[model samples]
Target: MTSTDSRTKEDVSSRTKKVPPPMYKVILHNDDYTTMEFVVEILVNVFGKSLEKATQMMLNIHNKGKEICGIYPRQIAETKVETVHNLASNKGFPLKSTMEKE
Candidate 1:
């Protein structure tokens, strides 16, 4: 085999290196009209947090005015934010969520 063929094989192997996808954080913002219980429910239903953990997060969101609910890849995080907005809107709450690269 020619040296060029060996170099081509090496290049292909090098290009096969796996890289992890960029992660994003999904955050919930507190609002005066949104109830604490609903925030906890969203945590439990959307982020799959346990009841206890969701309660704790709800407290943080209440006290701090915002909190990160979960870390996920870009598309998943985006979908999660959209879900939160839709759910809140359906329930007549002004709750909001956003995503940021992490």
Candidate 2:
């Protein structure tokens, strides 16, 4: 192929390659006042965990003081943290959630 054609093909190939977005892990922190039942509920409802898995995670949080709930894109991680906080606050619990690069 001509040099111009080769360069155009390279350019098109590069343009077609997509890079995945950076991911973040959403973590739930344990606290004295946040009930285990509530934590399990959040895991099941917000993170879409099954009852058995939610209970396991809840136990992990209770015993270890924290657990990573899920991995998501930055906006989704931020939204999950905010949503957990809002729900906890509305119910007068002190459960906290945070996001970290994955």
Candidate 3:
């Protein structure tokens, strides 16, 4: 190929390598006052988890004392955590959620 074509290809490849996928983690913390039902509901509503999946996640947090709710890009994970936390607080539940780099 021409030198110009090869240079263009190299530039494209370098650009792709520089743009990495952002990472985030959504975490649910265990708490005494947050009901299992509420936790499951938050999982379902906020995280778009199915009923079965929500149940399993709630159980994991209960049994293991904490669980990673989901992994998403930074904005998504932050939004999920904020939404869950708002719902819980509004409902008078002490359920806590957080996000961190994965």
Cα lDDT over the full model 1:
0.95
Clashing pairs in 1: none
Candidate 1 per-residue lDDT, tens place, 7-99, comes to 776688888988899999999999999999999999999999999999999999999989999999999999999999999999999999999
How big is the positional error of residue 82 in model 2, measured in Å on the Cα after superposition? 0.6
For residues 22-61, what per-residue lDDT tens digits would candidate 2 score against the true structure?
9999999999998999999999999999999999999999
Q: Model 3, which residues run further than 4 Å from truth?
A: 1-8, 16-18
Clashes of each: 0, 0, 0
Q: Which residue pairs in candidate 3 have backbone atoms (N, alpha carbon, C) closer than 3 angstroms, thus clashing?
A: none
State every prediction's TM-score relative to the real structure: 0.89, 0.90, 0.84
Highest-scoring model, TM-score: 2
The sequence of per-residue lDDT tens digits that candidate 3 reaches over residues 1-102 is 577656777787887786656888899999999999999988888888999999998999999988898899998888888898889999999888888898
Residue 72 C-alpha lDDT in model 2:
99
Task: Name the 10 consecutive residues with the lowest summed lDDT in model 3.
Answer: 1-10
How do all the candidates rank in terms of TM-score, highest first? 2, 1, 3
lDDT of 2 at 89: 99
